[model samples]
Target: MNRRLFPLFAAALALTVAASPASAAAPADAYADEVVAYRAEKWQSAHFDDAEKAQKHAATLKKLGCEVKTGAHGGHTDVSHRCPEWREISLKTHEKAHQWEDWLKANGFETRHAH
Candidate 1:
């Protein structure tokens, strides 16, 4: 291959990868808004090998409404904060949703289709 064409080919490959949808998504958007099961948030890292340091981290987490617990670490105890993860709420079936809509109308609440 010609040296000039080699550079152009590499540039095209790079552009292709960058333009892909997967590469375009941001970190927070990685977890889609799709409905999913309810699960506890996994323990996030505090970078502490000492229980005392971890306790301090846990204190901060607790202040922000996280439930924390400590587990066995190699040299000490590992503290991890358990935060609640948001679960998308949706009525799966249109029949059930319509039932609720009817009930809402009977109760004097206005309900309509999403469209």
Candidate 2:
């Protein structure tokens, strides 16, 4: 951890990230679309920082003709949308976010959600 080599390490990391195929494959909008699809199919849910963002995401789902259901409280901030077709793969009473993806995949759907 020499101070003089910090810049070199950062530059290398930057270059590595820049050259990643995942970074070049799809734009944010495309990923957003995938997330939207997952939500539509009830494969996942999203939690935004504010009500506005939640509503906005809900609006996107609506625009796509999704039938989103908000909590009984009427979307104060935390909204959970359910897809009737959703079949739970498995339930993890306590698991980290990283592990959830694989668990979900093994269950059935191939999806990811935005946090």
Candidate 3:
């Protein structure tokens, strides 16, 4: 820790960082802002902060006959799931849509018939 050598050490550290910017960020927030949208559609999704929880949710969605797509977004997973849309059911009847909404809500999903 000599005073005269401090400047040289600081200059070397700066050069090392400037030489490898990507490596410098690799250990930090590399994927913190990354979000890969599986599809361009405006689909409602389930969010899971843990990988295990995401996988379990995916499993249950699959069991519920939902076609799901899960993408890892930084520290969390976003699941795009759809069993049926409100438009797919008979809007004239509205019975199936209500029933579907109830089923989704019962399964812990926030549902709305705003299709």
Candidate 4:
């Protein structure tokens, strides 16, 4: 009985060792894929000196299918926008921000951190 159980235990240990690498690799592969996807994202951010301009920018980004939010950055009002579905939609949001930036500048509102 002891001899038979020894072989069974050894086999189970061997199997566990053999499966370890594959199980570990799955999460690493998933994290790598997530990193690649995040790197490929086209998220845009802009800073406005005036809260009103940031609000306008946020509204424009919302029209372009982006989820927009406002925050304070370096004592300036900041607006960030992202379209999670596709880069094309985010591109439209970015383009609209550029247009808004140009309009803001023309209207004498200085913009910063437009990236």
> Best TM-score goes to which candidate?
3
Q: Which stretches of candidate 2 lie over 4 Å from their true place?
A: 1-39, 72-76, 82-115
Regions of model 4 farther than 4 Å from truth: 1-40, 87-115
How would you encode candidate 3's per-residue C-alpha lDDT over 1-115 as one tens digit per residue?
1223323323332332111122123232231222111111244576767777667666645544457899997889987776542211112224434544444454444443532
Of candidates 3 and 1, the better by TM-score: 3
Model 2 pairs in collision: none
lDDT string for model 4 (1-115, tens) is: 1222333333332332111121123232221111111111245667677777566666644543456778987878877765544211111234444543443333223343223
Clashes counted in candidate 2 amount to 0
Rank candidates, lDDT, best first: 3, 4, 1, 2
lDDT: which candidate is best? 3
Q: Rank the candidates by TM-score, best first.
A: 3, 4, 1, 2
For candidate 4, give the lDDT of residue 102: 45
Better candidate by TM-score, 1 or 4: 4
Candidate 4, which ten residues in sequence have the lowest lDDT sum? Answer: 31-40
What would the TM-scores of all predictions be?
0.33, 0.31, 0.40, 0.38
lDDT of 3: 0.43
